[model samples]
Target chain A: MEKTINLTLKVWRQANATAKGAFESYEVKNISTDSSFLEMLDILNEQLINENKEPVAFDHDCREGICGMCSLYVNGRPHGPDDEVTTCQLHMRKFKDGETITIEPWRSAGFPVIKDLIVNRNAFDSIIAAGGYVSVGTGGVPDGNAMPIPKVDADEAMDAASCIGCGACVAACKNGSAMLFVSAKVSQLALLPQGKVEAARRAKNMVAKMDELGFGNCTNTGACEVECPKGVSIANIARLNREYLKAKCLD
Target chain B: MGTFFSSSIGKKFVMSLSGLFLVIFLLVHLSINALLLVPDGGEMFNNAAHFMALPLIKYGLQPVLFVGFIVHIFYATMLTSINNKARGSVKYAGGNNTKDVMWASKNMYVLGITVAAFMAVHLCDYWVPLQITGNVESTTLHGTEMHDTYALVNAAFSQCWRVALYVVGALGLSLHLTHGFWSAFQTLGASNSLWRKRWTVIGTIFAWVVGVSFSLIAILQHFFYQA
Candidate 1:
């Protein structure tokens, strides 16, 4: 049986990073329960366009939940009320009829809002650029199974690699700490044999960049793990700390 | 190294290391204090206290301990302020879900401040008089003349208000340690899943041990051994 919901959205509206932002309420009627949250916003945007009013702006790409572009704090949770899923994957079925949902962009000093529901996430890019890649010589691809990687190490590496960098962890954190995201990048490389060569340097540089970028320190609150779309473990944060401490010790 | 120490994680690492050092000191302090429970009329405690007050520990290790406290408190305040600013000016319309985070973990600064405040009172009551003023009465025990530190401790704990303060302080320290013990390990990179789980359990047990033991002495002194 097909169902529909009528929702009242209190979406944050801001002209730019410097402008004052506020929540503007709008009624979205008869939205199909099967439509994703982003789709429902699309309907509202279309209505605003027809009325000749400025439409709401939100960032989204690869709606399949992989691009890590959709960032929304729906009802106090990153990516709506859903666990381990992005905003685009949130469906109307989870909402109640006439329920008022509040939406806002990622709130952090590191992520300044560009407009409504869109914030600058280039801080992450900068941190990654600092030391997220492995250095290797230009040559033909290494033969498969050339490196006998333990299955456990490979699995853990893959798990850490699952992070799409959606910035949900920062939105959900009370301190706005990006430890989970930074740790994912650090751990993904640290767990692999190829990334072990510069693990210490990578850890120090990435963490230094994260702090320089104005991200909060991780207090082991576990909020980031709960709200992370990719289920990035806080253990990765522990590894980053270890790698960092080891590097400092050697220095 | 100075730059690393100035970094956020470096500050956290320093905090955790200092915290763990304090935790170990507490265990040693508690064991020596436990001698009061013996019916030996403060002989064992006085001897132990005399040894701890020796020039080696008093002048050398005591300064290191003081530095540890200073560093811990300094970074704690610094990190708290920076974290508040990092959260940005806009408050979330809906508050965070409490299920995802430990109450102790979220309010660590408050608990730390509570413990720090109590530490002031504690030093005023004990350390100041014994170390600086040398006003603590002396007793000859085991053929050695030493400050009757056990007498001072007993007199303080015998009072109901003093016992109450100590109990409250212990509770604050317990909450601080509950989050801090494992968190320090995590901050230092004990993030493996199995070890993290074990650390949590061990941390909880350690917190209780320190809290209950400290409070027990105060309550016992108040009720059982009235000065």
Candidate 2:
């Protein structure tokens, strides 16, 4: 038998970027327990559309959770109440029948709300544009074994690389810091042999760009790590600090 | 260095260094205060306190300690203002995180202010008379004259309210250090996944030990001091 549950959603509503927002309550019935949280929202949108109402707007792409687009502050958590999953990966079975869910946009000076639940995460792009890439001369592909990398280093780098640039860390942080995101970006590169050439500069520029974009400093609270869907460690943050210090003090 | 201090991590670096310096000073201060419980009629504590008042420590280490405190407070203020701006005026209407964000970690500035407020009373009870006003009663032990810091401390502790305040202050200090200790190391790039958990455990133990001992000394002095 298919399991379905009824839910009340106090979804945030706003006409435009400049418009003030508020929670507009609506009842969603018979949402399948197996449906992804975003899909459930899709059902709600379909219902609203049939009723000739302005549907709730949200950001989502690549529902498999790779694109980092679907953002929703579900209840009190950034991605509903699930651990290690984005909104698209969150299943409706996590909620009880007739549960009231309050949805919100990411609230931070660096991430302003554009519409109902869509926030401006362009600050992330700006930080990346500042120094998230390596610049090297074009050349033919080298043999895979040419550069011998440690297995431990490869694993750690992969762990950091898993961050999907979801603003959940920013939304979840009490201080509204983007340190986890910036740190993950820096660490994934800093750990590898190919990225060693521009490690120091990458750390400095990315951090400076983050600060310039109104992101707060890391207080080392571990909140970002716990809330991170990718489970990226704050250890990356420690590494970023090391790299940034090398650029500023040693260099 | 100037350019370094201007960046976000640089400012955090300042906080970490200053906070660690203060952490060390706390241990030293607590050890000296613990001497009051020696059951030796304040002799050991007075001798120790007098040595601290010597020009070598009084003029040298004392000014550096003041700078450590000032720098920590300055950076905290600066960072808090910047963080508030980053958080913006429009607050989250209803949000609650299930993850256990450390209670002290969230309210560090407030805890710091509580400790600072307690320190104000502490300075008035000791530093004002002993260092600035030269109004503290003096005694010559053996050959050298020193401010009777033991007497002043005993007098302050004898009051029930003051002793209670010390207990509260000690708890505040513990809460602050619970986060501040490991956080300092983390900011300095000394902590990792393996070490971050270790530092947190060590920090919590260190916080409680110092806090409980400081309160015990005060309570014992309040009830048993022969002054």
Top-DockQ candidate index? 2
Alpha-carbon deviation at B177 in model 1, angstroms = 0.8
Instruction: Please report the interface RMSD of model 1 to 1 decimal.
Output: 1.3
Off by over 4 Å in 1: none
Poorest 10 consecutive residues by lDDT, candidate 2 chain B: B89-98
Candidate 2 structure quality by residue, lDDT tens digits, B25-71? 99999999989998877788999998888899999999999999999
Clashing pairs in 1: none
Error of 1 at B27 (Å): 0.8
Name the fnat for model 1: 0.71
Q: Residues A1-251, candidate 2: write the lDDT tens digits.
A: 98999999999999999998888999999999999999999999999999999999999999998899988989888888999999999999999999999999999999999999999999999999988887865368878798788999999999999999998999888789999999999989899876788888899889989988999888877788888889999999999998999888766
| Predicted complex 1: CAPRI docking category | medium
Cand. 2 TM to true fold: 0.97
The whole-model lDDT of each prediction reads 0.90, 0.90
Per-prediction TM-score, please?
0.95, 0.97
Please give the distance, in angstroms, between residue A70's alpha carbon in candidate 2 and its true position after superposition.
Answer: 0.7
